[model samples]
Target chain A: MYANRQWVLAQRPAGEPDLDCFELRETDTDAPTDGELLVETRYLSVDPYMRGRMSEQESYAEPWAVGEPLEGGIVGEVVETESDAYDIGDLVTGQGTWGEYSLLAAADVAPVDPSVAPPEAYLGILGMPGRTAYFGLLEVGDPAPGDTVVVSGAAGAVGSVVGQIAKLNGCHVVGFAGTDEKTRWLTEDLGFDAAINYKTTDDYQAALADAAPDGVDVYYDNVGGPITDAVFTQLNLDATVAVCGQIAHYNAESVPTGPRKLPQLIAPRATVQGLLVGDFATRFEVATEQLSEWVAAGKLTHRESIVEGLSNAPEAFLGLFAGDNIGKQVVQVAAE
Target chain B: MYANRQWVLAQRPAGEPDLDCFELRETDTDAPTDGELLVETRYLSVDPYMRGRMSEQESYAEPWAVGEPLEGGIVGEVVETESDAYDIGDLVTGQGTWGEYSLLAAADVAPVDPSVAPPEAYLGILGMPGRTAYFGLLEVGDPAPGDTVVVSGAAGAVGSVVGQIAKLNGCHVVGFAGTDEKTRWLTEDLGFDAAINYKTTDDYQAALADAAPDGVDVYYDNVGGPITDAVFTQLNLDATVAVCGQIAHYNAESVPTGPRKLPQLIAPRATVQGLLVGDFATRFEVATEQLSEWVAAGKLTHRESIVEGLSNAPEAFLGLFAGDNIGKQVVQVAAE
Candidate 1:
């Protein structure tokens, strides 16, 4: 077995993380034991939620201890297995360490079909991000047909899918993305009724008003900050805001404050709900089947900005805050 | 038969409303038209919602025109009836002008049985406040057994009932109120598990944390602002926040700003839903029956801060902002 190289949290970041926060280290590979599978990493995911783990503060997720290897969604191939469930050639995806190799329990990883889709897809469109967009939008946002569905971070992994799903459901979909290019992709490619370039616009509320003329019925929020504050202004009566991720405030030095929204909510009779993908684990198979069907029908298009190599994983993660990725941010460790 | 004395919005206030904002006028009483009922106002409700109507700025409720007679919840006895639904001496409640005599359509008013409860109880316990507490708590808050339920404006109309209902449903109830007497009333009279006098406490978050040691499971938010912000800090995973009113921000000159709470909601997967009592009008019969049963059985106790005379109605409505009235604020326009 080759020596496993991994990225470990060297220091807890004060605000936005730099390269110094992560230490690329060479560690001895642990052999597969009974009931475990030694998987060689192929593709690793870099999501916004991982940023919360980098901090020392207590969040919904247990804070990752400093000096420990960063663990995330990883798509890997079964190299050597000591369990009865898998063979040497099966590709699996699960929560794993950001390394070349990880010793995981047999049940921890689910065997994925590369024939139905690409192996890297399990890290993006067909995986955590896909499920997050699905449940958070359909279950929490609860958009009805002909309703206006607005999504912040509309080009990111989850938000992109949320827009597409809302469009498919016969809703008037409006998207707020960071770039003009992302906005075009939303309107031209993804069937969104309107797209707002939030970075270019001085007044997001005005831009959103132009897009969602009927007002926002469902808001699937991935980027929370001023953009969300603007979205709150245009909420229709009985609006549902599904808080998927707050990527904007994830790296703040302290909990930041802005315009109070509680008052705004009362008049509209709106609903805002926080969501995590892990909570929908039980219904994953159902969501995956629906997501897979949409993908197969050419209705759902996915984009992945795969940064080549494990060493660039931290850089790719840091790039998310800069809006560097078009869709999913994945680290390609090795080709299957 | 007599000159109808009514209150009109004389001027829109810049900050806190004053007695000058209201002007008492003697208006001619309208005789009952065919299919209409002439009702003499007996018990008038002065609620926080009325404060929103006085403002020129558009809100959920229609703003009161400068010269028009103010309209609100009025329980009156039918003096003369041209409609088959109502008879003379029958107590009916509906939206009516602040004048002693009002011409109402039969469909506009509902016959309220004072024999089951009291004439004033219909304007208090089994009224809008009762229905507001019922739907906002059960439908929006969704408190579970052993869950910690926290309510702001605990001594007021809706809040006092929220704590009691939550307590009755087998939840640990914590309340926050402006005065020690109100807080004591919450614990001693209404069966709240703990009550914090927010006026005396410097750190409301700490006080709330102490009261809700297991963390807040459901928050029935009546007075939104810093109190709601403190509740957000102690929210359990999947907690629910029912936003009934923002009495704190109703009088603000502009849309007010405070510590942003959208970021805090992400981790806990909490839900904050804005509520308007009228939305649940379809199910109000069920709610009113439950509330009435509780009131009749002596399980529910209602205290009315009745301001005698219709001339003082404007002052009573303004008093809501000053935290002057406790429980349901009502104006006794005439004796039943």
Candidate 2:
């Protein structure tokens, strides 16, 4: 018998999650039943949304209970198959069991095309976050040609792709990031029209005015704070705001406070819509096809920050809240 | 030749508008040329939207300059005809100059039928606010049957109509009001399933939860503040928030600080959309016909708060900020 190492929720967090929130555990794994395949853990995605699931409250997805394995979307290789659907050495992606060797139902895993993109690409650009940016920006936000598109958290996985897609669609793309380096990457490398380093800026509203002089036609919002309020002030008539994430205020112990400027709703006739990627499950193929094509054409690019081992997953995941990760944060477990 | 009596903008207000913002004046009129005609103002509207127009900032409509006569959608009678298109004593609705007598282009006015509804009905049930409530709720909100529909400022013009329409559409209508009298009016006269007097209720979120046990599926927002934030917490999956107005925060000098709960966007996959009634101008007939049918069938009802005399218009308009008017506020300038 071999010990199966996994990460478990140690405690629910307050303002920010700490090391105590997660604990590494070793457990004995039983043999897989019929139709179950054993996958060797490889790439585990550490995302901002996982912060929400740590709590016990009811949410879009089930909460992660204390002492239970913390799960996330992951990619791995099948070492032993008890089902006819998967074979040995076949690489697949599905919900992570966190253990070194996890038993999954044949139905949960999907085969990946290695020739299309790198294995890590499935965890970032070709995966849920990528598809999320693809669908949320295109399907919901709907940027028209010459439209001024603004994206918050612009250096992150989803915001980066969203801005790129808007640029590709002939929009003048502007982005907001937490750092100067990220801002430079957006404007100089990622083809954004302008980039605002929100950290250094004294007035977000003024910065937005400078970046989008005409007015923001589409705001792909990932960080919902004062930046979003500033964007709200500058929205053009009939502007669309895709509420993809709100990492800025997620860990607050109490409700955050701000200007009661909701009256601004009267001016531009804006639409602020909240989106979850699972809502567009049926449209995944369409987004993947378009995204893959763009990547192959060198029109789209992605960056990832891969942590060394499963033990470091907690730190990497917590890094998202601190703006430490340059791009998508993923944990490399074992060699495929 | 008679000099026209008029009220013009005397000065801009620093906070709440007072008598100092307006001045009574008499001016000579120029004779109508080619397409122009002379009209006598009968009823001028006092609405919350005019406050937005008074400011110098860019908004949905141009700002009212100091020393200029206040202009809004009003009902009038054609006293003198210069264009071939109009005749004397023609009852018309137009964006009139706020004076006893004014000049207008023939094309600006529309002929009204006083037989179907009262002359004042043209200013209330058949007018701009009416059309605003009609299309903003039905077209954009699209409340499904059995949906828990919550409307703010429930005893006001737009909110009152929005509640009635939601009830007619088979929704469980819940209303929010500023006073006990308004709450009683909403429940007793407006057919709302429940009413919450926000001023009296210490916990709006708890009150809303009690009112809507199933959760809110449609929120027709007329007042945005803590009330809007409270409603955000109770939204069901795929909920729709039709932002028709934000009266609560309109007079605020700065944005209020509150618990920032934008993360709720991802939980419910919700939508908050701003509405401009003019955007649906092409379908005015559709709204009129449908509203008329509902009114005729006794499925919908409306109430008006009449303020006597043109001079009372400023005070009546300011009543909106204090939540004094129970229903649609209109100034009676003259008798038919």
Candidate 3:
């Protein structure tokens, strides 16, 4: 019998996390039930949202319990199926255990279209990250044509897609990323009007001023901290800040303090709204189809930084905050 | 000719204001010109927002010019009229100079009705504060029935009305104030479910836990600081934070830094929006009429802390930040 390997939560992190917080263990692969499908995970998504689950603090997503396997979006091939909905060798993607094998209910997984793009794209551009960008940018950010749309954590899974979508909406898109490579990718490949290397820039305000001459009208915020404060000072009248993530402060032992922005909002009559992709669950298919069309038409580009092997999943996740990956970070757990 | 005494802006204050920032000067009043109305000021409105105008900082309202007379909402009687639209002894309320007499166009001011409530009520419950509460609560706060609404600076003009409006929307209202008397007024008279004297309470979270058993759904934020931080932690899922004012930080020499709340907001998917009464200018008459009915039907109760005389306008304005008055803080400059 084959063994199933998974990375489990070993301990809650204090401040910045290390490999000690994760425990990789092997277990016996269970047989499929009467209504279950035996899935072998081909790719495992490692995202900033997973950081919130590593801690026991209250968050939108429930915390991962110590000694339990972490759960996330996984792309896998159905090895066997007890139900008629999914057959053997069919690729499927859904929320699954971060393990080499999983027994999932047929209704919980959606069939993946590897023909349109790579099988891994189902977990990146065609999945949660894609939907997050679609609704967060269109509904929450509300970028109008000719408006300047600024996105933080650009060149990441959601942020990259956000900039592309904003461009398609006829707005000038500006991006902020950690490295020169990411910034170059955003501006050269992703069609961003301008991109700032936040790590290399000494003055974020000046950098934004040079890049965004018209001022930010729609700020899609993924990394919240001093960068966000700098962006607030440049927000145009009636600017909208779509708070999709706060990766910068996710690992802090305590809530960090910063310059208050509420007073600044009053002057411009701006709006700051926190968002979750699950809130738009009913429109996933719409967004996914749109994203697929864009990708196919060469209007949208997706880049993936994949780590090989199941044991390296924890490292792949930790790399997110370190700015190690330029785009979607995923782990190749096994071959189909 | 009669002399008109007016309070002018002397200099911008560094932190908290002093009497030196205001200069009272005597000027002679000229006779009314053709189609002009000569009005004798009756009541002068003093509000917390006036602090922003005193500083050179950018805000919703334009800054007050140094050495020029400050203009604010004033209720006055028509002592002489050259236009057929207004007659002698008619009471009117509009943005007027901080002086005893003024020449105004008849169309610039609205006729105040003494029958609905006292003429001074035109500047309090039937005026800006009331309309601010009605729109900010209904449109921005968007409280649903049975929702728990928490209001900061609950004893102040806009906040007091905000609590009542939330209550009228069938929400359970809780308030935070500086003094026990103000808290008592919020609970006993304003129909608030609970009131907490934040100045006396050392533990805000525990106080909120004891008060808001179901958690806060709609937070009408009037004072933004530590109290606002506490409220952010207690927000329910999809909560709304209506940012009406930040009176607590108005007097600070520099922009104050505090615990970053964006991360906290991510979990609740909350919204923080800035509001101005002028935003709903098109619907002001509608709200004013509804507020007038509420006052007549005894559905709404408003309290005014009246300071006597125009010479004390500077003191009355200063009293707002010190929490010296409850509900509407206005100066009865002269009797009708």
Predicted structure with the largest lDDT when compared to the true one: 3
For the record, the alpha-carbon RMSD of candidate 2 to the native fold, in angstroms, is 1.9
TM-scores, chain B, all models? 0.97, 0.95, 0.98
Chain A (alone) TM-scores for all candidate structures: 0.98, 0.96, 0.98
Give the i-RMS of model 3 in Å. 0.9
lDDT of 2 by residue, B285-318 (tens): 7888888777777777777788888878888888
For DockQ, the strongest prediction is 3
Better of 2 and 3 by lDDT: 3
TM-score of each: 0.96, 0.96, 0.98
Estimate the TM-score for candidate 2.
Answer: 0.96
Q: Indicate the DockQ of the complex predicted as candidate 3.
A: 0.79
lDDT per residue as tens, model 2, A69-188: 999888888888889998988888888776687878989877777887777778888898899999999988999999999999999989999999999999999999999889988988
Model 2 chain A — which ten-residue stretch has the worst lDDT? A258-267
Superposed Cα deviation of residue B183, candidate 3 (Å)? 1.1
Off by over 4 Å in 3: none
In terms of docking quality, how is candidate 3 classified?
medium
